[model samples]
Target: MALWGGLGQAATVAQLVGADVGGLISNIIQAAATARQNKKECEQLARRVLMIADLLPHLQDPEVMRRPEVRRPLTGIDDTLREAHELVTSCQGKSAAYQFVMAGRLADRFRDVQSRIDSYLLVFPFISHIDITRRLDRIYNILLSNDTAGPSSSAGSQLDVLVSQEVLVHRHGVGKFTLKELVVATNNFAQEIGRGSFGRVHKGVLPDGREVAVKSLGKASSQHGWQGLLRELDVVSCLRHKHIVHLVGCCVVRQKKSLLSFWRKNVEKQEELLLVYEYMKNGSLHDHLHGPSSSSSPSPVMASWKMRIEILLGVSRAIEYLHDYAGVIHRDIKLSNILVDSSWVPRLTDFGVVVNWDEA
Candidate 1:
């Protein structure tokens, strides 16, 4: 009764919904009752003990007392007896249906209680019900597989695992975008404005007539799960610079999909990573520097001596800001990665392969 009350009180403290708590408590009580019934059933299955002892000679050895084979069996027997005693002490106050059903099952696995108990204790509860269910399912699959498989796969790399967990727990306000919206914005990834080692970029026009450039990365299959994408997301989401091209928004499917991080930080409220940004009208400096028109003509629209100097100065300042203020390194510092806005204001774009050089 005391133990039952303690569980009931714990349920209350956990703030479980009345319906959920009611179900859990009922199940627990049912399980306890089933244990008592199993004890009674065991009395009738006297032949079961003989068969078990025959199959497990370890139970006969004097050292069996210290071995799991003997300890588990004895422990199960003790629990069964105790459960029966408790049911009788209740004077039939609670239903014994749970006990009877539970005992039938326990009797079937009478030799494996220690393993089951060890497994049950290792499962840590999660705040999300889905997480708990997933963990339990994982455990069941692992056990069912007889330990042949490796540990369950996570969404990110080991470091990324920590970041994802922290974000879910602490960064609750962050919104996730979908792949469809990105596809639509980027015109099915057809208008190739720029290309990089990681992916390609295209010019896009949002519904409100706002211009944006969307970078479509290569497909990520099972080879690059959440952690790989998550590491990229974590790094890109937090980047902020006046001259840096902003990440406006991104979207991805939970299980299998590409990730899109946006940069759209308002003047007053700045997000360290993840964004929606003001788009640049003109394409990257690469389009003007080594593009077909620039390479053939030797003088693109923005490649005049005067404009070239301004572009160089602008890019230099952008690099300095990222290096000094943000502690970031623009590794691929070629002309093509730089963009010119409507006012000819140059912005540094693409940090997909950037490095961190805080000291320098």
Candidate 2:
């Protein structure tokens, strides 16, 4: 049983909800505080972890954990904890300057966790949620005080604004298709292939009989997902890398037809957004490395260090392209975001939450 008063629902694992946030905190505390930057970043990450810790116990209720809606946010939290654990541990015994460099990466990870927690706030008790926007404001002020950049172009201030912040999406780069086309391709949304936090994906065959994966955004997150789709289209449409998911087309179905009353109208609520991509026969690296989704046995090919290193290198190149050439930040980079094909080659997907360096 969980501590404090008995919970009505079976407790969802605290480790699952809170993940390694606490562990990261303790690890940082034990490490030698060599540089001002290292210590500052450590404190900031601890704060983020503490915010997550506050919500952990409350989310243990079976009612909350059992909800399908909670799965996505929960997975994101788990991924963050995993990344933090790796990062903090890797910094051990490094020089003060090296740790300082790692601090920069930690900031990126903190913002990624910030974006992940937004979805979690929707489904459960995030009643004490911290205001991330205010956190960004603090960074902005700090930059101004330090004279890092002029008011017009504050680099620290830009990074302070979370990737979840709204932006004007553009459409000059990608193909726009209608709902009819999507329906025809998916055979009326047949073949339930997989699912993610935003929506479900269906396997489809194109007019040329080429295989594809169609992702449909969920209703509750329709607006959020649309913004992401716009961002994804803008990013992926311009990039051509072997390790990047190809953006075949997209669908946005909006209806203006109203019932008798405005209050009863299903306007934006009824809209649908879908994105099409080339199908990956092997699904995701998460499935292979950890184990098959439906089974306990790990994929032998992926379990090898040699294969894993190659997979890691391919993903690194793709990310380098996004950062160095495309000039965008992939706020969400987790195992599930990396897909693999029949040859077990890794490819990056889901660019909706990526922020341009300028936009930060």
Write candidate 2's Cα lDDT for 1-360 as tens digits: 121132222235443454444444344334424324445545555445455555555554454455455554566556665655455455555678776666677678657755555555454443212223234355445544644343343443343232112111222335666788778988998798776546778998888888899988755676556556655655677888999988787665533221101122223324355778899988887777675344466574545998889888999999999899989888889988899987888899877688999998
What C-alpha lDDT, on a 0 to 100 scale, does residue 241 get in candidate 1? Answer: 62
Over 1-360, each residue of candidate 1 has an lDDT whose tens digit, in order, gives 333433433333123211232233333344444443344533333232222222222122233234343234234343433343343333233357655555555555544543333332232121233343344454344333532452244422332334333353333323444566656766776776666545555777777788776654555422222233344445556666666776666543332111221211112211122223457887677776666663455644444788888878888888888777767776777777788888777888766566568533
- Looking at candidate 1, the ten consecutive residues that score lowest on lDDT are 256-265
Error of 1 at 86 (Å): 65
Q: How high a TM-score does candidate 2 get?
A: 0.46
lDDT of 1 at 182: 56
Candidate 2 regions with alpha-carbon error over 4 angstroms: 1-173, 254-271, 293-300
Q: Ten-residue segment with the worst summed lDDT in candidate 2?
A: 257-266
Per-candidate TM-scores read: 0.43, 0.46
Which candidate number would show the highest TM-score if scored against the true structure?
A: 2
